[model samples]
Target: MRFNTAPAPHLAPTASTRRIMQWVLVAMAPGIAAQLWQFGPGVLINLALAIATALLTESAMLRLRAQPSRAGLSDWSAVLTAALLAVSLPPIAPWWISVFGALFAIVIGKQLYGGLGYNPFNPAMVGYAVLLISFPKPMTAWLPPTDLAATPLGLLDAWSAIAHRAGPAGSSFDALAMATPLDTLKTQLGLGRTMDEVQSGPLFGALAGKGWQWVNLGYLAGGLWLLRRGLIAWQIPAGFLAALGGLSLGFYLLEPQTYPTPLFHLFAGATMLGAFFIATDPVTASTTPKGRLIYGALIGGLVFVIRSWGGYPDGVAFAVLLLNLAAPTIDHYTRPRVYGHPG
Candidate 1:
């Protein structure tokens, strides 16, 4: 008896990589708008600069690697990476900051490791982490929300601050900037202040931080849009938020004076963006349904641990990078059984 040896038929999905990336860009619009409203035009400028730098670096690396530069560049992966890195940085971060970040992300973080899919870490997070570590003062000098700023930075002032390295009247960017809620909380808590005291600080506001709360809300809206469009699976974000919220609630219930509430944990930092977008990167994240839940939950749990006890005020980048390292292991164990396979 002769047996037929034929390849399995390919099943078509409604979306392509390009389409997915386009949707990702569209989903970022609400967040981008919020940043613009709260922070001024600096955010848009940084995004443009970062995107240009990323495409240039991506093309250069692809050519050097003897790959098709146009094809690689057209995929918009580098653009997305640049956008994420840019948005995460202080809006008025010096020009070189975005430039160096784009270069590091495209070259060392992505290409040097054998290009996009082969890299173990998320390129954008790698770039952000490096910049944060190297330029702590500049990176942490986030602008107080428009309502809190003694002098809201105008377009020209913002431009001058970022471009000329000085604010109006010889003041520095530092004079016009304030700490993020996470940074504020970390320092105050380290100084033995209670959670209530920290929440009442100048940096804190009705929702969370002066301006950061609006930014987080913007990202939250954008993330919800992404979910509505089905660009991402609900498993990762749902699992991550559930874990983070549950853990924070447990801690808060155990000691209200010491621990921040779930709202603070959810809206204070990069929790929403990380949960909906960053942690759900299909390439770097787990693929199987079960694996995705495990991956997301692990990230959320790690985020709580890091925020509560670790050095970093915000744990999104650290948590995502750590979980990226374990994705393969997660996939191995969580693989779904074949339909006809015997258990």
Candidate 2:
């Protein structure tokens, strides 16, 4: 009998990167649908444009780098990054904004750093931050929640708005644009208004902003679904929310006039999204369970600090990016000890 041996051993079948990314995309669907329903058709248009631009840019870069385009595209990582970026951006922002952001994410943020696994930052957040800083006006121009709009944009109107800066329904894009709840709170706080006064405004939907609360709830539902599917673990989200809520509660209890309620901090802006999705990016976040908790706590703390003191109305992107920078150090320090090794 002759024994044949190969240089490398074959492994059993398991989940592929593409399958993981696909699940992530699926988990985002509820939030995306809710955004479309609440904010009109601009979100859908942005999603389409961003996806196209990301795929195009990814393909072009792969070809230039002498890598197989089909394999790279099949991973769905680029599409997930594009979708995340698109959802975070202002729904009514011009077509060029999404195009530029997606291209920058795929090329500069992801590829220039040697593609997905090598990138230090979350590609989607990098794109969002770039657009937010470069085009302040458009980036902050969130549409009034569907209920508040005088004339909600239809699909054709949304297309026209992106294409021409005016809707087919004869409304200027500016007319449809409105400040988000976090923006309103930040501006009001800057003006020296108390939380009570700001809460009296129509924008305050129940505990959070009006239409925005439902959007947050939708995202929360999706996040929980992801948790149930085992696509994500509970440690990150639990730690993030616990830290954020703990801090917010402490502050609000100390000074009710100045600080908003803990519920507001949890429901407003991208708190839920950041906690579940953004901060949990496998490539950019800590790997150890203990490290993940620490990482998430840091993000939550930073978010509170930035929202309360920093110039930006919402701090999810900044918080996530800052935490991403610290993830490696966190992993290094928090790695589990070997079972048979001495301390």
Candidate 3:
């Protein structure tokens, strides 16, 4: 009898990294659209710059390593990293910011260690952390939501603001930039103000903040889609949200005048985005089911700690990077035993 078996991998692959990356980009659409509606074209402008720079840097790195550029580029990991880093930046950040960030993300964060899955840290988060540490002022120059902006710029004017060019009718870039809702709350809390007093501002919308709730919801919706499609593990997001919300509820209940509501914490900053998209990154996250829950919970706890007391208003990036360092250890301890093996 003739055997029909080839080499290994007799079953065809159900998914590719490229395909997964494409789905991630698609999942980001709603959140991106919300940002555009709230802050205008700054995100798009930065995204274009970051993508171009990431591709160039990736190509150069691939050539240096004597690898096929098309295979690397077609994988879409570079694009996703670029998009994530670009989106995380302040909308009015200068063009050089995105360019520099993309360079760092692809070259140092990813390729320096061999590229893609080889890198231990999330490339986008690395770029973001570096930018945050290096350029604190520019990194925090977020524009207020359109309704709250005193002089909201049009698409051309937004580009001009990013370009450091004078806006139409002498509108200034500084006029548009302000603290994010999270920053505002943090500052007010530092100043010993009650939640009720802080919530009176236009910055605080019905749920979280002006435009922020919708952005978080959009991401949550996209995240749900990915879950349904089986592209990501539910344990990570579930554990993250549960811990964050649970902690927030505890603090808020203890001092209603001090801490904000659980919904505010859930819908604020990068909570949903980090929980759904960033924390669930398969490479930096744990492999085992139980390990993932512990990993995500630790991240969530660190986020709460940082936001409550640390310097940064949002701690998602830092939390994720810190947790990335522990993923291997978590997997080691949580590894399942063989069915027939004795302890």
Candidate 4:
């Protein structure tokens, strides 16, 4: 009798990667629904493009490497990577943006490092970082909330905007696009405006930004379910949110006029998604329990620092990538004690 061998970076000893990826995809449904309601059909468009591109790219790469495409394509890792990257993108970005980003993610970020569990960085984040660096304008070309846009985009309108790289007929891209809440706040504070003044602006919402609070809530709900299902560990998200919220609270209390509130930080920009979905990536994240907390807290700290001082508005992707490099060190120092061994 012969047993088949598989690749590295498996989610767990008990769970197959396909099942884990399925749960993750299911977990994102509510968030995707929120995105559609708030931002229009851009998420779906990007997701379609990314999923297609990632699958094809991964298939080709597998064949080139003489690996079985059936084993890989069935695992759903590529699909999960694409979904994460797709949702992170500007909803109405050019069609090529998703295609190119997904290609790079599967080709370089994952396969180049020998695929799946062997890759140190999160493939989705690697794609996002490259896109942000190479195509900053398109990456940041975000549509305002459905209620805020001059013309609300239907499915065909979204398809048109993505394909043509402009807004619907008679509307300019400028009418549809706006800076995200994090960006707006960063710019306003730089201009010496008070937080109150900024919060009263059209883009600001009750908790975070218009449409953003609900989206975060949607993801938060799914994340909690994931926690309950034991698909993900509790330490990572807890430490991440706790540290981010703690830091935001300290700064907001110190200078309420200068900083956005903890609620804003928690609900705006990719805080919940990054904390729950992205940081909980088993392959790239810390393996040891204590290390997971430290890893998460450090990522949270980096996110705050980058948002406040770094060039980017949101720092989740960069924060995750940075710590991906440090995961080994963290796990080394945080390893649990051996039951029978003592110093």
Candidate 5:
């Protein structure tokens, strides 16, 4: 018998890092568009400044680490990180604020931990948390939706607001700022207001905030698309939303006057964003099939607990970061048994 010789074995990954990052960026377009439609031109300004800062910082870090800058930059992890952090921020924040956050995200949150997959926590959330802690005032200085604002800011006005060197009509930054719906709700609840009284303002619409609910819907559309494309597993998102919704529903049913509607909790603030995008981060989330569910549920539960009782108005970033710290432990215990391993 004649033996046929074959070439040496080769390795090829089905989806490269660049491709994966591209998908993620594409998935964000709808959410970003929804935000722009509702908020105004400020989001665009924030995104531009943030992407620029992220790329610059990523390049610098790669150089310092003696890594190939081109390869690192091409993967677009920096871009995604910057975008997530940007969206989480108040759109009217100064350009320098975004620059600082992007720099911190790329450097301390990523490179300092050996970059990308090696980082135990989410880089974007780290930057966001740091900014929230350091610059509490500006971080919470959100603007009302364009339709709600008495004077909807034009592109130039947005530019002036973000630059902080000039004002559209000699008005201070605070003049254009308004509290977010979540912030308003928390303040009202603290003042001993009923849920009905708290959500009576124009800021509160059908479900969540006036313009914010649509943004969450847009993100949901994108997330469903990502799921259909098999880019992300459904277990995590399902577990997260289910846990949050279940818990919120229980409370709302018990004391509707004290608690906001369950829909409000589901569609408000960053709940959808965290469930679909942030908490689902593969590098920082649990890997095992069972572990993913537990991991996601833990994040959801923490979000509820913190939002109801903690200092922050929204808890998605904090919840995700906290769970990222426990992901390894979750995966270890929940790992699937080997095909031939004994029970």
Candidate 6:
């Protein structure tokens, strides 16, 4: 008997890359709006600068590589990368900072390795990590949340601060600047302060820091929207949050004086953003279902370790990059057995 030999199990149609990226961008809107509401026009200004720079850089790189820029530009990957990097940056960061980061993200992080799907690391996180390491002071100089500021910063003030690195009249940079919740916690812990005493300050809010909880909630909401729309896989965020919460809870329970609560870790800094947006990058994240779980758990564990013990206050960028490097290996070992085949 003659048997027809052909590829088995044809997959059904799925969303196009452009559509997926569009959904991702839509999901980011709430988080961006929250940042704008909480911080001021700096968020918008930074995003504008980053997006402009990213598009320019992407165009230049595509031209140099002799690839058509139309599809690349239309994909919205570069725009999303710029947006993520902008959000990671300090609200009042100089224009040059945004320009440099966006250019690097597109040209070096994405295009250098043949663009998009070929890049092994999360391009936005790579840009963020480089800026953090190279320009430590500027990168770490976050503005005081609006509610916590003695004088709430206006759009004009944010513009001036970014333009010339100066706050409004009668206000020094020191007056406008405040350490992030993670940074404050690390500093206070280094100074032998207990968790309770550290959190008693006005910096601490109902859960995380002032304004930050709302920001985190906004991201969480957006992330849930993405999940509901099937834009992202569920395993990664689930594993990430579970592992992080478990580790943090254990530490807090063991020594409440020394460790902050799991909820604080969950709602503070960039935890939600990193878990939902950064670590779920389809190009760089583990592809297999089981691999994704392992990848996310690794990132989560590393984040807790670095936040608690390492030099950096928040380790989202570092953790994501590290796990990105391991994604291929994770995928290799976690591949599911073919149907009707032996494991």
For TM-score, the strongest prediction is 3
Clashing pairs in 4: 9-117
Q: How high is the CA lDDT of each candidate model?
A: 0.86, 0.89, 0.91, 0.93, 0.89, 0.91
Worst 10 residues of 2 by lDDT: 5-14
Error of 6 at 209 (Å): 0.8
Better structure of 2 and 4 per TM-score: 2
Which 10-residue window of candidate 5 scores lowest in summed lDDT? Answer: 5-14
Query: Whole-model lDDT, candidate 4?
Result: 0.93
Best model number under lDDT: 4
Q: What are the per-residue Cα lDDT tens digits for candidate 6 across 180-239? A: 999999999999999989999988999899888889999999999999988899999998
Regarding TM-score, does 1 or 5 come out ahead?
A: 5
TM-score of each: 0.94, 0.96, 0.97, 0.95, 0.96, 0.95
Better of 1 and 4 by lDDT: 4
lDDT string for model 5 (108-175, tens) is 99999999899999999999999999999889988888669888778999888898745568877777
What lDDT is reached at residue 3 by model 4? 86
Model 5 scores a TM of 0.96
Model 6 weakest lDDT span, ten residues long: 5-14
lDDT of 1 by residue, 89-175 (tens): 887888889999999988988999888688888899999989988988888888777777677777788778878877877786568
**Residue-level lDDT for 283 in candidate 5:** 94
Kindly provide the TM-score of model 6 when superposed on the true structure, using C-alpha atoms.
0.95
Error of 4 at 86 (Å): 0.3
Off by over 4 Å in 4: 1-14
- What's the C-alpha lDDT at position 343 in model 6? 100
C-alpha-based local distance difference test score of model 6:
0.91
